[model samples]
Target: MTSAFSLKRTLNLARWNAVLLTRNRLAFVYAVVLPVLPILIMLAGERGDPAVGATSITTVFLVVGLFPVYYNVLSQFVSRRDELVLKRMRTGETRDAEMIVSIALPGIVSALVISAVVVPLSQLFEQPLPVNPVLYAAAAVLAVIMFTAFAYWTAAWTRSAEAAQLTSMPIILLASLGPLGASLADSNETLARIIDATPGAAMNELVRVGWFGFDGAEATEKTLSFAETWSAAGPPLIVMAAWTIAACSLASRSMRWEPRS
Candidate 1:
């Protein structure tokens, strides 16, 4: 019955947010449809290419999982604040963490569902299963956590719900570009090093390692054992952890509870 962390209240808020999000056609399209576009395109492009590997499919899954969470969560937070929903909630029994989590729950759940679906679909397409399930789970969890923190950071500067798209673009562009840049890493070392440090690229890299048992930079058929997965996971994990800390720290400092206007 802890008021600060009431499970019942949190679940109620989450359910309400999920219902609201599903009703917004625009939000639903961006959260659910937009992310799927890239995967379809990839499936078409790689249709007969025997060179298409599990790494490529894993990258698609990463995109489907992370981008929607970032965009939808940012929009939700800003829209609620602009409507004074966040302000009203502040006067209620909801705690800060609960408020944020509730607002983010719909998008988070959508991302998770998409991530889960990606696995089975990949299997259907003949892509190899993840070599280390633990690493895959860890990467997925960390990706969501890191992006959620960055979403809050972006929301702090967003003045209105309509402006959320524009304000969230920088992070979105950075994250989107990172994976694309990583895809071309074999041809470019400098870009590889830089993109590998980015949150999105790091997440994708971890997924590649977890599923393929080899980092994207080193394409090998050798399966990574338990200790090897952790070893390969280290650098990307560090990079993601750094981004998470920086984003959360900055967001905690500047986030506003009331409408900025």
Candidate 2:
């Protein structure tokens, strides 16, 4: 009985949040546009190089998975807090976890949908299909979870909806560097090690391994066999898992249900 009620409330909250999201014209535009922008940019410069194709596919997937969580979920959380919506919701039957999940569902769903489209369409665009679908799926799921938790973490500091953009920039930059994980590994081993520990780099490394079997190292000239070994998949999975735990912990501790007065 309680479980059923919770599910109903969660679904209703998600639906309401989705409607609010679609009503925001600018955010709606971003939801529609940002997922495709990297693909278009990559496709435009695609020269049939397998290495480039692999990198492009990794970049597109990471961007699709991370950007929406940063831009949409974080902003919505801040906006709701500033407007006292979260405070009001808390006074009702909605639990904190449900509220967080409901608010994040729309952006997370958008990111997942884009990722689903990007993966297959990537092959059509002449990129290799994901050689390890399980690894790719795990990485993408972790990306969404980590980013959503980080969104809440950022919202703890963001003063208003206007501040969300600025607060989110640091994580955005960190995740944005993920696409360059391969090149960075080749050029500067120390820097590559540092970046690989981050969630963004984890996303790209997982994709690299899944698509090109190359674990974010210097791209080889020849096509490689699909390598889904524990050796290839373990490190990034650990990194993402650790980050997800830390982010969720911090967000739960620091999150403010009411506007800062």
Q: Can you write out model 1's per-residue Cα lDDT over 1-261, one digit (the tens) per residue?
A: 555587788889999988887799988887787666655644755543323554455555556545567878888888888888899999988898898888877777777777667777666566666778888878777788888999899988889878976887788777776557646788888878888887777887787778777645556464676578888898988998999899999999999987854
lDDT of 2 by residue, 127-185 (tens): 66667777767777788898898889889888999988788888888777776665667
Q: What is the TM-score of each candidate against the true structure?
A: 0.89, 0.90
Model 2 TM-score on a 0 to 1 scale: 0.90
Worst 10-residue lDDT window, candidate 2 = 220-229
Q: Whole-model lDDT for model 1 versus the true structure? A: 0.76
| Clashing residue pairs in candidate 1 (N, C-alpha, C atoms within 3 angstroms) | none
Q: Local distance difference test, per candidate?
A: 0.76, 0.76
